[model samples]
Target: MPVEPSLRVAMTVEQCWQPAPGGSGTYIRELLRAYAELDDLSVTGISAWHRGSPPEDGPLPVPVRRVPLPRALLYRSWQQARLPRTGGADVVHASTWAVPGRRAPLVATVHDLAFRHDPQHFTPNGVAFFERGLAIVRDEAAAVVVPSSATAADCVAAGIEPERVHVVLHGVRAGAADPAGVATFRARHGLVRPYVLWAGTREPRKNLPRLVAGFSAAVRAGADLDLVLVGPDGWGDERDRLAGVSADRVRVLGRLPATDLSAAYAGAHVFCYPSVREGFGMPVSEAMAHGVPVVTSRGTSMEEVSDGAAVLVDPMDEDDIGRGIVEAIWPGAHPALAAASRARAAQLSWSRAAAQTVAVLREAAG
Candidate 1:
């Protein structure tokens, strides 16, 4: 066997310390762990000075070295002053667009151009910050990596050259769910049998209001499954919407530990994630990996992640979403849909994502 030449990688991991640590945090952790299993590269995590390790949810996969400032100051410095250059590696990978000074060839992963798609999704300052980051990516980055063709199209529309853009789909790390743990999870939450599952932050972009409405419609149409919601509370006042919903049937089980979450996926009758948009819908792929038939948005990245194994609907239409959910759980659908979901999910793996990322980083360095 031949040995693969390796390069040192300085990859930003600041998202790991964030309080919410959404999908981007997952990206940093999973990619580094995948990198550790490979001989193609050696990665050193980069973050601002912080008191302790990342939250207790998981272990750190790589050693980290810090910059001189706290998070806010460091982010400001990167966007405007471009200080404390990233020079200790063969190439620097800005895990998100909050890039460091370009002391080495810089390759940046842009999760999505959500801010650009609709400025209202972000605060005024957030939009400005993202604009600054995108400008830097356009002018300074040796390569720009995106998670989906949908996001790649958005990047080009925002004026990044097509040739510099690379689409690298995210990996699925979801494992088989435990039956005993799943039963316990159901009992603990007072969940009824054959429930439809929805996971992800409760934000405007997640389109929860419409999901709730659609779910109500599904129930009205005589779909037997109850609806179960999971994940951390994001910004939104869904009270008014949920008030009209059948409170007795809907269960809002907030965040769970990873084991229980996988159990939730394992036990779902249908996984419904009709968010308005996504760069890559990690949860949808995760649900599919668990062999649950999915109902997701028709044209977004979630549809791509589902790989034709899911039922697609227009996210903007509560009625269409309702129809899709009903279809997914319609009689005589589970066996084939579940089989396809597993097959499509089998195609995604972290080792593959790690190798593709290393190739891009090396291309930037070369």
Candidate 2:
């Protein structure tokens, strides 16, 4: 009888919560869901805990183990030391910058080097954390996984070997139109008609101040368009800038569940993401999947993700962003653009990303 090959894989989830709904959290959830279905692999997950206990019972196709750390500092130290013991498996994958000191074919995912390149956009602590973590990633990780070729380039520019970097795109969850949900979300949020949607945390890099300026300009031009900003209110200065805009013309919806977010996307006339930097820009793909016309940034991952499906603008140019929004809202303006957006979205899927990730793990294990 042929013996079954021993394949054990360890996946790190440093900042993920099992039931949370943020982007990184969602990425971990989707990755685990896909990894669970693989036949020949035994997977283990390690994560950080703060508020509640980690879920105990997981009939999850693979075993999941959560290691609780007191704080981010402790977590980083644990990542550098305790990970090898925690991840007793043959291969280890760090989803974020939390690198293991004693590496056994380590694969690290570098979302973006934004904190390095755009220090003005981040807090001092954030910049320091990224610099330190990235140093560990460069020194320890055998291969680096980036969400886009743009990010891969960023990694190479940061002194990582280009050959060691791989680009694996993120996928949006498949969702159907929910009119009632849409109406409920709109009503609850006091959303009126003729709105453009911008979804993401209110970070300086999101360029919300610029977006507000552009939107206000469009509104002044008799566009009569409202702007909807969805995501968390983590940005102090950016939030204040957004608040300075006319409240009647701008609605900040904080964060919404996936279902409502889909409906919100469906209801929007166009999705505008003028982020100055991004790893993959999942929201752009999500907007495309929902058949919403999109206007995004020209350089960085936004352009690569949009693939001519959406209007590409100079993010720094308020005039360009405003004009893009106007063109998107004009009736029967860009049929080809809309069609291409959906086509581009159709090509991106979570399964493909998982398959690629698994292949990398398998290769590294060998």
Candidate 3:
């Protein structure tokens, strides 16, 4: 077989994956892994870090080059001005909104327009920065990749042409099934019995307080269950509200490794995600892949990603969310629904996401 011609491409991000596990980090990791397997593309990853420090190395499949700068402000300025200074690529992909000044043609992945649509979720400066940066993406990027159709619609709503945005869904990495890992994760996180899981940062848009209320109501109704939250603490006064939930009934296991996280998903009675908005709710798909039922919000990408597999509820109504949870956890309740969810999850793969992304990059280069 003849090898496909390789396109030299540079992928840029704010941080490296070796030391973190946020959404952006996960996105970069999957993207790199997918690109590395492509015979038709040679990819190099660039990131912003400190100067004079040796670049951190990892087991990434693609070549990585870190450009050190003094601070985030300086790094942003450098990215806008100096990235074009050392260019030898057919295209540059901005994994997180910072584009090089005059480099090769660019493709940007705009995960969400949350900062614009829900300004209350972010700081004033952060909202302003995202608004301006997204505008740059709309005007300058050769093409913009969105994680969901909702985000693609947001791009169009923000004045970008509909033709310029592409929706490329993301997927979880495949791994070995580990029952021991599941048990260990439950024990370490104080997840005593069958419980509903909510995985995401405690942000306003996440609607954590509402979820707490819903879960609390379920427990009070004698649902012999717990609500486990897995994510780092986020900004906003809502953290206090979530903290107020009964500690015995609400377990907060902040950030776990992928292996343990997968185990947690597998061990759960059901996954409940009631966020009002999102680029895509990955946890819903992930939980379904583990053969666990899911209860998620109805609007935005939650319903789209769930794809009739999970229990859908109105996020604004605590009673509805509670009812959905009760139904999901009811023993042998929705075998057909659970089966359909697993089937849907089987259709999503990181390789497909990578292929779609590479296609966009090649098209942009042309």
Candidate 4:
């Protein structure tokens, strides 16, 4: 096969200079890792600096250019008086609505329209910022990339041209299952087997209050299962949802390293993520990649990502969520469900997403 010509691509990775409190950071880093493998792409990463140089995450396969401007100043300037430095590349890609001035063809990734759809999940300032940023994206970007069909539809609803929207499903990496490590993680966190795992930030959009209510109901129904919540404290007080639940059965682990988190996924009897809304539920796919049976919400991208393998329940109904959890974790459940979950995950790959993203960037460049 003849090799495709290399495309000059400049990506704004200011979000990656620090640890990502959410999935976007992971998306940026993983996409970059896959992009680095392409011989037909020359990539440049751009970030802003305020006081000191940008922090490095080991050695990247590509070069990075740090603009000597604070984040606030850069965003303010980009919105009004200044332009982001893109090093004159053919295509300038913003990971999440951080578009630069007219330097190159723009490819913007709109993670979600949560700011508009669910204002309660964000601060007023945050909603305003996204409302303004998305306007720029819709008005100026040559191509728009979304993680799921749901977000693609959102783009069209927001008045972006349908032809300009592309849905590139995110990939999942299933690491080798470590039995010993799984045992260690359980012992370290005092977690028992047959626990339902809930990963992601504790936030309103995640619908943790309902999840906790459902878990409490399941326990009340004599289902002997523990509920483990992972990730950092987000906007809401999650404990308010766990009002009457027994302390011994519910574990709140703030955060664990990737290796341990993978082990937790592999060890769990079932993974539960009944989110109210999502562009793409990374935890659901990640759990599926580990051959774990999943219970997620219906009528959202979580259902799309699960692809008929997971048990879908109404996210708002605590009783329905509770029943779904009981059925999913029942003894001698269909082994094929676990296999199917992994199979669904196998179909989504970072290499494929990277190649498609590069193609979109090339098209926009032309």
Report the number of the highest-TM-score candidate: 1
TM-score of each: 0.96, 0.91, 0.91, 0.95
Model 4 per-residue lDDT tens digits across residues 1-366: 997788988887777655443777778778889987888889987777744433434444567776778777777777665375465689989887566665788899998997778898888877877887898898889999999999999989999999999999999887666899899989998886479999998888899888988988888888888898888777666646655587888888877777878888998888999999999999999999999999999999999999899999999999999998887877666476788798999998998989888889999999
RMSD of each: 1.5, 3.0, 2.7, 1.9
Worst 10 residues of 1 by lDDT: 235-244
Residue 13 in candidate 1 has what lDDT? Answer: 91
Model 2 regions more than 4 Å off: 1-6, 18-21, 49-62, 79-85, 243-245
lDDT of 1 by residue, 203-244 (tens): 778888888889889888988777888988876475345643
lDDT against the true structure, each candidate: 0.86, 0.77, 0.78, 0.84
**Best-performing candidate as measured by lDDT:** 1
Looking at model 2, the pairs that clash are none
Please list all clashing residue pairs in model 1, or write none if there are none.
Answer: none
lDDT value, candidate 3, whole model: 0.78
> Candidate 3: lDDT of 339?
83
Model 1 misplacement above 4 A: 1-4
